[model samples]
Target: MFNSAVATLNAPPVSIVLNWKSSYDGANGALIDMSQAVPGYSAHPDILAALAKGASDPALARYGPVEGDPEFRSAYADHVSQLYNAKIDRNEVQITSGCNQAFVATVLALAGHGDRILMMRPCYFNHESTLGMLGVGIDYVDCDDDGGLLPNCASIDAAIGPQTRAIALVSPNNPAGSIYPAPLLADILALCQKRGIWLILDETYRDFMPLDMDVPHHLFAQDDWQSSLIQLYSFSKSYCLPGHRLGAIIAGHDVVAQLAKVIDNIQICAPRVAQHALTPMLTSMSSWRQENRERIAARATVFRTAMDDLPGWDLLSSGAYFGYVRHPFTGVGSRQLAETMARKAGVLVIPGAFFGAGQDGALRFAFANAGRDVIVKLADRLSSLTL
Candidate 1:
């Protein structure tokens, strides 16, 4: 027999296969894959060389510091300090296998069985399942579709209850791509502080935000920022290293110390080879990374322009790597539509319903993985369909 919590998210699978199994006759079009949230590009040549060198050197095969390699940790801490203008030390950062593992550690650290964590509806499916499998009830704040999927502050304020232990949110959100404004974030933090709950802010797409946008928060500069905030990020998107399984957790030293225990049990430590390889890139390839950011931003623009006024299609929210669009089929379930799309339209995308407690009308497109040339085809693929 399966666990009850497992049954909750057993609700449905992403099913790129189930979709293609039926209609993949090699007829309509070659598959346009956009299912997974991974970098479609290659890793840095220097890092690839480093990985090769590490493979041959006999040095990187052993266990590493559970918190992380000191060199990589110090390098990343310095990187964080430079970006946020906050004086963070290596002691405040913990490397994990990936951002997913980082989220697991933070959730395990903050809440447990029968406890609850508030998240916005139409969330990252992984976040939803993580809580479901852990027996942590997910409390969802309904996102404002007309208002660009941003959570209404009052809803978050209203969602908190005695059983709520924390609030976790992905900014430049996975399905919606809505970036929380500074004032809105401050209010959320204040709300969390007043309610005595932790705030797990996932900034995985921070590197992809527009160059002109401000950093996500001022809390990094606060004296007690560590006490109330747990920040998560991925080196994968920024450095094209998801396969290397490297991510970092930024929290107060005490929280970092506790989560280190969970992380130690999780993956021993993050991939040290990748961590070390990224240190130099963080310092040396600023221009390349910024250029990559611009490239992804351009991809988002392509999706926006492509779907601008298609009948019954609505681009409700877009930013970072994702764009949430309302599908024209008003009565079709999103899960069914997602499958129909993958099979019929030759495009793979995540259903919005995968995101949260209530998401019936939208589908999420992570358009950044496609290059400009490939992105050009999306308009046609979308236009060709009559869902």
Candidate 2:
């Protein structure tokens, strides 16, 4: 027998979508995979060398601190402080196997069965499934395409119920890629404080924002910001090291102490080699990170231009690594259309239905997985879709 909560859920969306590839015979063209938000390029040579060096060190094979390597934590703290223009103590940071685990640990620490968490619709599927498995009820604030998929402050305030423990948000959101404005985030934090709930903000795609944009937010600068705010970030995307699976949690020291218990049981510590490898690179590779940021931004421009004036498809919202698009087929479900595109058109993407209910009319394009040339071919491939 399996746990009904998890057993009842659908298979992982990426794997499900990828299975349709078996039907493709390279008839259209080389398969342009836009299903997962993997970096289109290779990891920097220095990062790879560091990873190799760390792997060769026998000391790193053993377990390290449950929270994370002390040196890595301190380096990451300094990195965060510099970016946010605030002081973040190393003690307040907790490293996890990946951002997904960081989210899981935060949920485990903050909520339990019968408690509810408010999330925005078109939410990250992993977050939703994590709550479902833990028996935590989830309430969603539906975001409209017209609003660029940003949740309304009034709606968020209204959605907070007596049992709501925290509000989970993803900036440069997973499916929609809409960046939440700094002012709007502050208002939401104020709402969270007034309602006596936690604000779990996930900034996984923060490094890929438009180059002209300033800091993502000033929440970290506010007095006692740690008491109400817990921020999550991923090193995998920025470093192009998803295989290493490293991530972090920035919160009050006390919160980090509490999450340590969950981390101890889930993963004794994050990948030791990864921690040691990335610790120095956090500061040393700033220029490389900035260069990749520009690369991703340019890809976004190309993808946006490629989607323009497409007969029936509408690019509802796009930025960072993804584009949420509305397909023109009136009655066709997003999953069916995505599958068809993968098989006949040689393009792979995720169906919006995988994100949440009422998203069946749209699909999520992880444009960062393809280069400019491949992205440019999208229009032709999509235009070829008759169904």
Tens digits of per-residue lDDT, candidate 1, 70-184, equal 9888998999998888898999999999898999999998888889999887888888888878888888888877777888778898999899999998987887889988778
Candidates in order, TM-scores: namely 0.95, 0.99
Stretches of candidate 2 exceeding 4 Å from the true structure: none
> In model 1, what are the clashing residue pairs, if there are any?
none
lDDT of each: 0.82, 0.93
Put down candidate 2 lDDT per residue, 1-387, tens digits, no spaces.
999998999999899998998988898889999998899999999889999998999999999999999999999999999998999999999999999999999999999999999999999999999999999999999999779999999999989999999999999899999999999999999988888999999999999998998599999988878779999999989999999999999999899989999999998899999999888999989999999899999999999998895787899999899999999999999999999999889999999999999999999999999989899999999987876
> Model 1 lDDT vs. the true structure?
0.82
